[model samples]
Target: MFSIFNIHRMSVTKQLSFSFLVVIFIGSLLLSLPIAHCHNAPATTYLDHLFTAVSMVCVTGLSVFPVAEVYNGFGQVISMFLMQIGGLGLVTLISISYFVLNRKMSLRDQNLLQSAITYDSANNLKSYLFTIYRVTLIIESICALLLMIDFIPRYGLSHGIFNSLFLAISAFCNAGFDNLGGSSLQHFQTNTLVNLVIAFLIISGGLGFMVWRDLYHAARHFFRSKPRRLRAFAKQLNNHTLLVLETTAVLLILGTALSWLLEASNPKTIGQLSLAKQGLVSFFQTVTMRTAGFSTINYAQAENSTNLVYIIQMMIGGSPGGTAGGMKVTVVAVLFLLLKSEVRGQTQVTYRFRTVPRKIIRQTLVVLIFFFSVLLTAYLLLLEFEPHLSPFALFFEATSALATVGVSMDITTKLSTVGRIIIMVLMFIGRVGPITVIMALLQNRRREVTYAKTDIILG
Candidate 1:
């Protein structure tokens, strides 16, 4: 049996795991309420309710049905709330709660916060937590105002306001839920302004809070400094920020080009559109694939090659500390750099005049091992459960769920209850990523015993 004290004494990892579970369960119950659905909406099973709750709380947006068709406005509010909390993270919310109560965080709480955030130190904790919330509210509010320009006439005053707010939160959080809900923003593909604003929100959220904090601090310094050169602002940013920015820029460009090249001639895709629309849609394809999950094109009808690229992009998702999930941009960047160095016969993994830490390499390995292990396990289980579906589709579904990308083949509604459960687990793991980050953040002590190095045969 579990006691309150025992629960309180649990480590940061366990607390996070338990916290997400609690939120999911509570959200499931709330969404299952009678008022949550329309009077004429088809009756849904608790599993479906649970699945939807997990989808929103995990910020995955892989619903088993059309959300707007089934759920009422009240349900949408509940879902938006879930997305907001999940995007901001449970730890950050808890910190906010403490702040509201005017409670001081214990040393244990500080350590937990540090481990939870993977921050270098937990000093000035209030400012950090406030900054995250402040930034989120400001961005989401601005995007909402911008979106209302288009949504107002289309949806009427009240509906437009709500829709704009919901869409804005969803986009910035990379949750991908849309009340418009025919083909997710496909109707707005030609609305370049709306698309661009959404793209900005997606990119901003996907960059992660670390970059946001760094940029915020940099801007502050630039304002205070005697000379305000842009380079000085950039100089204040650490290599990690630069690495994330560089990797993100490269992926977006390459992904956009690859999507355009592959799908430009596919009649089922953007091939019929004008060059400008095609380019815009292709750019959206790559941008949304960066864990935002909005689709301007029918992924079901997309070329196999295009889907392959999208899958890779989903797996190599947004940066750390943000709402986005996946193996993460930094992980891919470090591994690729490590490989490049190894091929060049360099002993040290050096990048931009800095050496990659040995600890980071080990942590990266742990993340990959944990990530791939779960991904493969889920893929195999999905294959067993969904034998009628193609292996490739299952792989795509598994990867999407594991990365919390939410883009799926037209098969989500066809999944069995057990399959949905599997997807829920994947979403839970992907968003929280305790298994991926826990071992890396755990405190390890130096071993007194020394052993001789052993050689192993390799390919």
Candidate 2:
């Protein structure tokens, strides 16, 4: 007999894709129980539960119904578990189980784990995997406690503590699901503590684990040396980590500035906000576009220009091998570097005086093409199904789904059933990744034939 969860028998990519499906299935079943519902919850369908399961398991945060209205404490706890599991990934959890059971990881296990998260190290995997969990736990816990400082005062003891924990996990996981009745931190827009803490979690989660490890080493190197220079410390890091950091900084700064300026005069959003509040709100909005999905303002009320800026930010999400999704900052950076090198008539594509490999260049192009193609297809299909909604709204929703960014234009509830399924599929694909899905679907065939190549055309 064959099964999707037969991990040892399937390819790594297949295992990666199928594991999420299994989790989603199990989550849906758990959520369907009568106990998962609130005492006076609205009538909830299986479809809604399944959709919520997919949203939670994928860490996508696009739900058909408001979670708070439907789910009781038990159900909300289940949702949090799914988000954490999805965020850290199955490979990491398997390794954790091994750690607990004192089982040694086989070479095959290492390879599969490496391929799943794109982690490069084979020897240091145990440390790496553990580090990921430790970091997630510490960050989420601390942030959750800090958030309680505010939430406890407003919502009171039990609900306050739960809300803080949920928001902390959601923000760090980039899951973006808020149970605070849809407004999603809009009331906290003026609260500096809430805004900054959430933004910090988003940025920390967006930077890949590899980048964090590199920074950890850099920190050690700095303190150990007698004469430590900041520039020297930065130069010591690999080009990939440096590139991700640089790109993240550039995107955040640019996105915040552009959004703040564009929506400054728009009465619906930032116009009523003070200048300082506008800046703070703009920064949080920009951070959320890195696939975090926690909104401080009404996205639907924003000017078209501001929304355009958001679409771009969503398309180019956060760094790779982290909680966030999209093509990744490193991929976009490499593409830009390749373009610059080609335009300069240079033989080698370089960034920060380091040459990028041909294999990496090819992978970047593939990712860019695959994500763009899928997003466009979803957009066109949604437009067909949702003729009543604004074209821009549909586009925003589609991009958000494709990027695994939870930012919506206040149109999620208005989506038709077909449209909802389409969004769910996009979220799954986006979370598993375009490359991984393609690799999983492809047969394991070896092609060794070589033929003479000829030029077909010239522009």
Candidate 3:
């Protein structure tokens, strides 16, 4: 018989995956209860409940039913709870429980926690976990206060506070689930306060905890030291932090520029807004497309080019260790560096005068290939199940689901039952990560044999 300790013996990948699965199951059960739905809302099927549960637990905001119309306050609270746990991660919650109980974490527990957060080092794991939770709560609280500044007067104290809290958590977790009527921040598209607040929250959350730590340390050193030492502290930023910030900036600029150019003339999109609002919306899209699902514009009415741009952006999601999903910015950076090295006929992949290990390159390639494979499989199955929808819509939905980017083309509710199931699977795989899922399924057996290598012809 399996004991409690047996769980600790399981592989980190399996434990992580199982933890999410269990959460999804429990969330589905909670959501399926009648109290979770509105009294006047149409009767929801079990599958629909399961779908929403998976989406929430995966922090992918896709929904088959309108969140505001179908769910009452109770249901919304349940959804938020699921998103909270999912966003913070189960391993994180477990670690916190251990800390709260004053139980020392075993090395295995520390390793699993490190794996969940994608932190390279296991040293000082307890401190890092505390820091992560503290940072999350602080940021969410600040964002909630900022949002309440606008929401309190408009929504009243009770509703406004709830909205602020919901949006704050959603934005910080990169969950993208909003309680705002079905329009999802569309009404606030031109609202500067709403736009900037959500944008800031999304960016901060998507930056990942490691970057937060790096910035925190840098700030402390800079402030504590003499003016002459500021430059030295600035130079202390690690390559990962620098790479994430730089790539994020480039992607945001690129996404914004492309969105503006492609949709500037369309009356349904950015074209209908003032120049300043247009810029805001464009910038918001750039920020949100990196796996945050909030959207000010109707993506269904977007130009095909714009949709394609978002597809690419969603696929190359936020940085590693972030709440956001997709292949990750770091993988893209590695790929770019790899391409550069190959074109220059260099044998080693070098960045900032440092050589990237071959193992890292291989792992990046594997992750990229795995993501595409899963995406392609899900896309094809969705096409088969959702034949009535346009190919572009189906493709976009698949990509969004897999990337855990909840942006959709208004076809989510219209999808067939089987199509929704496919999306749920994709969302699950996406949240757990392609590599983790693969590792969980495939046994990592080591071979003692040393084989000679031979060169193969390349294209």
What are the lDDT scores of the predictions, listed in order?
0.84, 0.84, 0.85
lDDT of 3 by residue, 324-350 (tens): 888989899999999999999999999
Candidate 1 achieves a global lDDT of: 0.84
Please provide TM-scores, in order, for all candidate models, with all chains considered together.
Answer: 0.95, 0.93, 0.93
Instruction: Evaluate model 1: give its TM-score.
Output: 0.95
Clashes of each: 0, 0, 0
What is the TM-score of candidate 3? 0.93
Tens digits of lDDT, candidate 1, 1-459: 887446556655666677778888999998899999988888798999999888887888788877787889999899998888877775455674467757556776676565556455547777777778889999999989999999999999999999999999999988988988757888897799799999999989889877888888899999999878998988999998899999999999999999999998987888899999889999998988888878888888998889999999998989887888888898999999999999999999988989998877877888888899999999999999999987888888889888988888878888998899999999999987743275335545545797999999997
> Whole-model lDDT for model 3 versus the true structure?
0.85
Give the runs in model 3 whose Cα sits over 4 Å from its true position.
1-6, 90-116, 228-230, 435-453
**Could you give candidate 2's per-residue lDDT for residues 37-145 as a string of tens digits?**
8999988788889888888877778887788989989999999999888776654556644676576667765665665565777568777788888888899999999
Better of 1 and 3 by TM-score: 1
